[model samples]
Target: MPASDSDAPARAPWWTKAVVYQVYPRSFADSDGDGVGDLGGIRSKLDYLADLGVDAVWLSPVYPSPQHDNGYDISDYQEIEPVFGSLAEFDLLLAEAHERGIKIVMDLVVNHTSDEHAWFQESRSSLTNPKRDWYWWRKPQADGSAPNGWGSAFSGPAWTLDDTTGEYYLHLFAKQQPDLNWENPEVRQAVYSMMNWWLDRGVDGFRMDVINFIAKRVELVDGPAAATGGGSPMGPQIHDFLQEMHREVFEGRRGEHLTVGEMPGVSTDDALLFTDPARHEVDMIFQFEHVGLDQGEHKFDVLPRNLPALKQSLSRWQDGLAATGWNSLYLNNHDQPRLVSRFGNDTTYRYESATLWALVLHLHRGTPYIYQGEEIGMTNVRFDFIHDYRDLESLNHYREAVEDFDLDPGTVLAGVQTMGRDNARTPMQWDASPQAGFTTGTPWLAVNPNSADINVAADLSTERSIFRFYQSLIELRHESEVVALGDFALLEPDHEALYAFTRTLGDETLLVVANASDAPLSGPLPADVSGAELVLANYPADPDAAAHPTETTLRPWEARLYRL
Candidate 1:
């Protein structure tokens, strides 16, 4: 029995004990031999997700789109893309997910809409249109420059001039995705109505994409914040909008629905405001501070790994939100490269590193999100040429670097190979088949060549399987209060090779020690864990060592858990 089991309340939010699995639909599984993965493919994998022991499945956008931003540029919010299926198929998928005791979370991308969306089309149709105010529109400067100096996240200026309207519009991302005008009350209500529609249809909640960028400061209307450019317009009105959204869409249904905002430039203090229960904004947020530790000037400008920097960033969030707010823990996602290849070893120490990283992540105080291919140790891809990449960010940046400037092609390609988003978009490795069992037809993206060895069938056949390890971790979270409600504290804070932490709730203390490097090392045990009980370890536990539990030696990429 868990030591703090009695202290935990029976009616705590379902999300507090939940484990969310993110399924990038385009690459998760392909059905009907269409090359593109669809709702049916996800439906076919419901059993696999349930068997994996996830509490909720978060599906990336599948709305009707032009496929410019891979469904993020939604043409119709209420309908599924033809390639993915229809609204009826979505309803069936939702019903099936609920039948297996798993909740479904839809990605909400209200920050922008596809330029082809009816709303944007009407807004851009003519200046006299009723929906003209639905989007941010501005005239060019006297010098015929863009409305402001803001740059696009996908590369280039944030403002795009419409040929017919002779006016510029704001787009924080790709030009095809235009920013919505949240200053308009009608726009807010429209978004709220759409959200309520999804919740009413049995969808559990939303994982909002760039939700924080919805409310821009008034300064972004005509000019830059300073000479350096407006810089991803975030302002005070964001909380007001979120609170109003909660009151409108999720007011009556508390504790049943989950809302996790994916805020890119949010700070710890600001995250507390957004997630505080009293604020009534959101349940948790996905902050980018920890993920940006390895990034140099920009995300693609990757730097060598720094264990201490990563530890500090994660610990800051853990401690900052310990009292009021909540955190969403994730190492990689649809927009990120595979964690095993980026942070840990994907070659010689693959299994050890993968399970060790999983153990470290799950033991953290926040709710852990497992990306689809993480459990089996799927890794980053190595596409030799730039044309093999599909993400707009990679392609656009490569073009700007090579054609616009005279940078070496090989140097730029190295960044794409190391940290490009395409690495995570590879087809899921279900088996050792030619297609990696993801599809009967050619996959939309190439299957990572190493899938034959690092796949579900191969891993499950091994004596120590990563899938089984993740299953145990999920079960542990469901059963232990110390894991769900514990206060976190970092140990060996400055250590370069070892990562250690402790979680404490009431009189219960759980310690985790991980050797992140590929070298045998010894460190002193924390004083409180002198006679700790060895609860779990990636490697075999020695009976003699387990008796006293004072030794602090670890193998390459080793991890251990103890109860003190």
Candidate 2:
């Protein structure tokens, strides 16, 4: 079993030294051959993660739901969905993970619940109902329209009218998920109880979804619509409620439990309030500033972003969080397209590009998160039609393009193909078998067409596969104390084609160099220091290349990690 932190010193938190592996359960491996991954399938893969040297596994939501929001809209948190597994299966999976020194962190999506949730069902029954205050509800406008122009994250008005109750309920996402009213003391107590209940059941921690959206703008001001007429101002009162929540529930949580917040629109300055160790509100906040750097006028537009722009944003996050709060470094997740295709040349140098990007992000001064199938260098799915999309966000954007903006359906569908979450939700590729080794039946989402060439079974046999490179990188992070908690400094900020940084802890120093461009770039070492050991290189060890003494020559998309 994993060493119990209960018996360890209080100062050394397990998460601080841990590498987090994110498992989008459905896209991870399908052990039942049903084309959809489940808890048992994840249970079977614990050994793979253990061998890869990951310390924790952050499982996406698996709660009972209508699948309206892909399990984010939960009807029941206390029970596992039949599609995934039974409650007993979850316990067994947890135990199995612990046995391999891998901690499991469940995704806590308390910001909203499925309209099918008992709480929402009761709240929507009647205005005078006992549970009416559980969710945000407002009276209709004089014209019988929405209460305000506030927009949903998925695209339309945030308020959903219920003719039965003569009120409109707020939902930042799909109308199927009504936002819970954190203003209600009863609701706050209920959420706290739920958190305690899960922690008591042996979960290592939680990955809170849209945590900042828990508290809304009490005044309910009408937000200015986006140029696309879909923008919504994220509420102002969010911080206050989060502070209160921390004091009441998270202040004295048992065992060094980790808490990572999905707080979009959080500026670097505001991020400090939630992430500062002294405040203890959250261990880290997933700042989306870097991810959206390349986004176009529309949310789903797959516009190209400049490499310099990406480097600048990444540097800003590193510098801003250097002393305030920690960062949860990641390139892809359930919400993003595959990094290999999005930022790198996934077709030509897929494995090389994936390794280079991983080296650039993982070696930074923060806890790294690896999405499932990413280590094998997964690429995005290609769809010829909009109907192929499983994500609500993509569908909403496509509708806007076709119905409102009058854009060509083909163009809109092509954009969705590039940026849709369905690209990331494809079934995990185990082998070049029937159903891409995902399942015997048709999967909820289709597997990537290129899975045959990049399945785990094939990569495991290849010495130079992206998966093996990731394994080496992860092992290096765990064994080197300096890499885990070193001070980070960006080197050659103006180097247009190079993303280089130095991580140092006292006299122990490690330099990470990446040729961000597609073309070869040769340059002098960041410093005049010597005796640098070619500890780990994405390419062959370049003794002759280093023999030149002063300058370093890096091949196209080359990446290297050196210890001095």
lDDT top scorer: 1
Candidate 2 vs. truth: CA RMSD?
A: 3.8
| TM-score of each model, in listed order | 0.97, 0.94
Which regions of candidate 2 deviate over 4 angstroms? Answer: 1-12, 221-237, 251-253
Error of 2 at 329 (Å): 0.4
- What is the per-residue lDDT of model 2 for residues 294-313, given as tens digits with 9 covering 90 to 100? 77876676567677777777
lDDT of 1 by residue, 245-350 (tens): 9999998884488899999898899998998888899999998887788889988798899999999889999988887788899999988899999889999998
In the predicted model 2, the residue pairs found to clash are 33-439, 33-440, 35-439
Question: Candidate 1, 396: how far from true, in Å?
Answer: 0.6
Off by over 4 Å in 1: 1-8, 223-228, 528-530, 542-548
- In angstroms, how far off is 210's CA in candidate 2? 0.4
Give the Å shift of residue 113 in candidate 1.
Answer: 0.2
